[model samples]
Target: MSSDLGRAMPIERPDPLALLEQQEAQRLPWLLPLRHSRMAENPFAFFRGAAVVMASDLARQPHSGLMVQLCGDAHLLNFGFYGSPERQLLFDINDFDETHPGPFEWDLQRLAASMVLAARSLGLSEKQQSRVARRTVCAYGKAMAEFAAMSLMLMWSAQLPMKDLIDQRPSANLRSYLAKVTAAAQSHDSRQAVRKLCEPDASGTLRFRHQPPLIWRLDQLDEIWLGGLDWHTWMQESYQTYLADMSPNMQHLLSEFVCTDTAIKVVGVGSVGTHCPILLFRGKHPDDMLVLQGKGAELSVLAQYVDLPVPEHQGQRVVQGQRLLQRASDIFLGWYTNPKGQHLYVRQFHDWKASVDVGKIDADGLRDYGILCGWTLAHAHARSGDRRAIAAHIDEPEVFARGVLEQALELAELAEQDHALLLRGIASGRISST
Candidate 1:
């Protein structure tokens, strides 16, 4: 059956280098070296940056054929804590750049494989790594079963609070670690972002500080890069289009602020080459400031594999997918296309956003974190997909869990080989080492 729980995994082997090269062809040429350098760090790092490769591979694999809005890159690193509209700290999937409606298993598989690679990076024993991987899969099955019986409103309003997560810690050390992460997340508000990225210029105006290669003001770049256009005018036009997309309340909230400065900021391993502009705005009061990011959005890699409809506007696709998967989304979330036809989604640069430091977690902590991530993924899927069908498919929980774990292990092995291939490509000069 297409929705069978224990379908055999596919054995087709695609060329990882080919897929990666294809993806690189679309990214900024200057940033490809940085992307390559970052992915070269380790298997886990490679896994995080190689979503397109996995998407290509998963397309050939057997699936339940149950479709859901996927967090296309659901690796552990992408799940994080952020402040909800109500100022509550909620743990959920944070990145939706590759999001699209596709096979439910694609998300689980990516997440499971990530667990395996992450455990390996942490120097966990094979047995311990297998345990962590299995725990993540089992947790998903258990959580989906619970969600299957939930009322619509109950499911909609449900959130995993930070305190509840901390209380579930397997040991005192893990609990202490979570406490520190939560504290850090709580402190990562707009003020901290401003302090880290902004300073008063000689004219006494708060402006973004210049950081070359990673961040810089548009004025600092040559005319050739700017295409002889006025930076301020171009930025203002983009800002107005973004403002027009916002709701009246959001617009009114933003109306109190005026654009102070804008800069080209490089962000994330996968998103490094994209057009990410940080816009700083100041409100009526001297200290009142807001930072917004205009991030370029491209079509999801899943679109090539699935028979999904091509999104008319890539930015809107990201915004819609984010709203579907996240329990609460950024209030300032919106989309606009510039005159150059570049699709971009706008949101607060940082509003109490934080992520777990995977390296700091011990074996016990990894297992607990894996379970939390599984639960979070299940919740997101349950909200957007048919939970009953998923629950029924995972009817025999242990059996389904075992199946997922086995497949994850298989895929992780493949990913390791792919990582090796990348290293060889770099050594052979087929790929850049920079």
Candidate 2:
């Protein structure tokens, strides 16, 4: 631990089931929405809007052992938005707060449960839900098999680009939508992003303005970064390593716009309590801009099973994982040890992105999207783990896909039941909340 951070932030470990019991009453409110979600059925959505019990339930769960690289909290809604470095607007896994290496099953389970949840939302018949889920798992299984067989070099440069994504399905509406999303994505880099997200102060200096409740600029943190001992070292020492790791062109470009910027809390469901900060900077030209995000890195939800070292710095796990998982990672992708010795992983915030809404998709679209996510996730996982063993284990995608969907149905039910318990716990005040 850094001398600056006197005591490490003790890792939080909560009893997921008991926490649910305590949060149950509070969750009774969103039971209905959860039920109608695409994952499972029979939830009571009486007072449908609530995040309290949901947050506590996820916060309390025991870690899963299955992360050979995993997207922490792989629920459906967590995926969405942003542009890619190529200036293409594409969709893929966006959140990585709980990312860690353990058992790969954890990521699969979370993803399946999310699908079931979305299906429930559509009020699909049990059979319909099953079909949608089956399609998704099958796609995932198939994709994993394909990924496991690739050559090392191919795996490294591999990308499920938007063209390949839209081409898999050759219909007219999708074709049109693909062109639209593609065009929009190409024009959505950080410069345009800054224009859309920033505003001028009365003094004419550019500032990010919050539109009432949704968006807010966080320049206040400048004091914390400037005056704090940890921040001083991080800005001076860590910044070099961060810049060194960027791609050549990105490095040169970032050289111009890499000035200090403010950070802000953005959005996510499972990651509500986590630190997700965005850095805003202006380059040589007023229009030259970049946005980097510093998201909190914690022990993987898979920590319970893995033989990890005593948590020296939580951010190390993430820094290595992102390096391992993505082919062309952000130039500033690195970890920082804070004054309080907190570990944080940094990346380009609002880097191009997109995700298909599994919940809103028709049964066919749901199946296709699931296959894509499975394929993409498998490629990521295979790169991080023992590819030989994983490939051997999942040689057959079609059969394994079916089994995953079946298992997901069961897991989805459990998630719903647990969610119910959480609502009760919260309503009874067994779990404290503000």
Q: lDDT for each of the candidates?
A: 0.85, 0.55
Question: RMSD of each candidate?
Answer: 2.7, 7.9
* Clashing residue pairs in candidate 1 (N, C-alpha, C atoms within 3 angstroms): none
Q: What is the alpha-carbon lDDT for the whole of candidate 1?
A: 0.85
Report the Cα lDDT for residue 210, model 1. Answer: 91
Q: Model 2 over residues 72-158: C-alpha lDDT tens digits?
A: 556655454455455444465666655665556656656666666677766767887777666666666666666667788887667
Over 1-434, each residue of candidate 1 has an lDDT whose tens digit, in order, gives 14332233357766888888886675667777788888888888888888988887787777887888999999999998888888888889999999998878899988988898889988999998888888898899899999999997898777776787998777676788888888888777667788999899999988889987688787776655544667787787788888898899998999899998989898988887887889998888867888988888988878767766646899999999999999899999999886666899988898789888888888898899989999999999999999989999989767887888888888788878888888888899988867
CA shift at 273, candidate 1, in angstroms? 0.7
TM-score of each: 0.95, 0.73
Give the range where candidate 1 is weakest over 10 consecutive residues by summed lDDT.
Answer: 1-10
Superposed model 2: Cα runs more than 4 Å off: 1-67, 77-92, 170-179, 210-255, 258-261, 308-312, 429-434
Separate clash counts for every candidate: 0, 54
Top-scoring candidate (TM-score): 1
Q: Name the Cα RMSD for model 1.
A: 2.7
